[model samples]
Target: MIRQATPADLQTLAQLHSQCFAESWSAQEFARLLAIPGTFALLADTDAGFVLVRVAADEAEILSVGVRPERRQQGLGRALMAAAAERAFGHGAQTLFLEVSANNAPARTLYGALGFAEAGRRKAYYNEGGRKADALTLKARLPLGKSA
Candidate 1:
């Protein structure tokens, strides 16, 4: 089931992140983000997927989204994203943005499928071992009138 994430979910979120990223965020980092005024998170417990977002004014930024490697390709990422967007809109967000490593084809494809468009790019934004990867900025306009 998908649900809003509380501070108590930090360890599980961090564990899921570790399986998805080469450089995973720590539980302390997740705590700090969650403590921020506009930050929010959602989790799909059974699928081990989670999405973190920060909304301010009419804009929302996706901080991170991940599913355990073993649990990927099962639509968990999409479900988490849909939940996050709905929650952000309910919180007054009119648009959403996120940055993904250019090298991450699967994530980029998923975002594109969800109607996110490339907005910009950041050069050498991710440090992968001894290499650097570019980051792609993506944006999606929320259907404000349908928000609940």
Candidate 2:
């Protein structure tokens, strides 16, 4: 089931993130984000996936998203993205943005399928082991509606 996340879900979010990324964020970091005025998160419990987002004025930024490695390719990511976008729009966001490593084909594909388009790029944005990777900035226009 998908549900809005509270600060109490930080540890679980951190654990799930660790399984998906080489550099995982800590519970403390998650707490800090949660404390931010415009930030929110959504968790898919059974699917072991979560998405963090922050909305300010008419814009929303997706801070992070992850799914347990074993849980990927099962629509968990898509569900999380939909939830986050809906919530952000409800919070007054007209546009949603996110950054993905340029080399992350799967994630890029998913974002593309969700209607996110490339908006910009950041050079040497991710550090993988001793190597660096560029980041692609993507943005999508959110449907006009209240939060579901």
Residue pairs in steric clash, candidate 2? Answer: none
Error of 2 at 64 (Å): 0.3
Candidate 2: regions farther than 4 A off: 144-148
Query: Compared with the true structure, what per-residue lDDT tens digits does model 1 show for residues 38-147?
Result: 99888896748899999999999999999888888999988888888888888899999999999998999898888888899999989988789999999888852342
Prediction 1 global C-alpha lDDT:
0.87
What is the lDDT for 66 in model 1?
91
| Candidate lDDT values, in order | 0.87, 0.88
- Candidate 2 residue-wise lDDT, 19-108, digit = tens: 888788999989988999999989996648999999999999999998888888999999899989988989899999999999899999
Clashes of each: 0, 0
Q: Pick by lDDT: which candidate is best? A: 2
lDDT of 2: 0.88
The model with the greatest TM-score is 2
